[model samples]
Target: MDAAPSTSSRVQFRRRNVASRARWVEEAGAGEVVESKGKLWLTTGVTRGSKLCYNVEEIGFLVEKGALILLNDKDEMIGIEAIYEKIAVGKYGCSWDAFQAYKHLKSLGYIVG
Candidate 1:
């Protein structure tokens, strides 16, 4: 019989779980962000779906990608042009992104809130 391959040093992956944002980014590059068990999970080596993050929409716009859309927890594509416009005009205000930013930074191993 043929000899079996040795595999005792490889780390196993935990599905529906995220290691960290910095780890996710380093491993995923630009993978979709998923919220599982109240934590962000990325497709490290598995297939999932796409949900755009609007915080970097400016870069997308600058890159000539046109209007950017975001998705909710349900993974539905939704427009946000009006919201950006409102933000630009100070018609609407928000701190939701701030919270996510902090969470992301923290997940990325930063000393942020």
Candidate 2:
């Protein structure tokens, strides 16, 4: 019989439980500005989801792919690809609008990742 894999060689993933009121940092191109609640929010290229809400914020760095990098307001990198469709549509206008925004940003030579 084949021997089982050794526990020492196994990879472990620790799930982080975000607090209810936790804030996220979103990373976007240096000049990109995201608006919310009449205030200017930076696009960290990161989005996050919760049982009751979704949050978007600014990020100081960039990530690969179109994945949004989420961070806390303190500038600490936290999560990625956390933005969901429903929340994105609601917050960033509609699906079509969001797509347009993505394209516009990309055309400006800013990395969307």
Candidate 3:
């Protein structure tokens, strides 16, 4: 009988879409005006035979002068101005704010293509 392969020869599988937390800010009678302080799993832009891959990252938030701020691991401010400007004009209808935020982040080089 042949022995099984060593531990190093075994392939490891990881599951995507793990759970995380998100903070929602609501206005008086408005319902979920903003969301912040969450850990999101973002794609690394690598495709495996047609499927996309993602990894998790921690995010922080700050509301300053009516702007929704997103901070990095070093607590540095990542610009969300373009996103806000786009939203103000009602251009991002049908899509939720989360999606818009993702797009904005991607555009800013935070996420790879």
| lDDT of each residue in 1-113, candidate 2, tens digit only | 99998756222222333111223423421212222221112332333241122223222112223232344466454444443332344553335455546545744656554
Residue 7 miss distance in model 1 (angstroms):
60
- For model 1 the local lDDT of residue 112 reads 31
> Against the hidden reference, what TM-scores do the models get?
0.22, 0.25, 0.19
lDDT of all predictions, in order shown? 0.32, 0.34, 0.32
Could you give the C-alpha RMSD of every candidate to the true structure, in order shown?
16.1, 13.4, 16.9
Tell me the spans in candidate 1 whose CA falls farther than 4 Å from its real position: 1-69, 89-113
Off by over 4 Å in 2: 1-69, 73-78, 84-87, 92-97, 104-113
**What would the per-residue lDDT of candidate 3 be over residues 1-113, giving only the tens digit for each residue?**
99998765222222212222222211211112123223322433233344332211112111211223333335444444533443445433323455446445654557533
By lDDT, the best candidate is 2
What value of lDDT does candidate 2 attain over all alpha carbons? Answer: 0.34
Q: How well is each residue in 1-113 modelled by candidate 1, as lDDT tens digits?
A: 99999865222344323222111221322224333232222212234354432232221221122212234335554344533442344322224464345435544555531
Considering every candidate listed, which one attains the maximal TM-score? 2
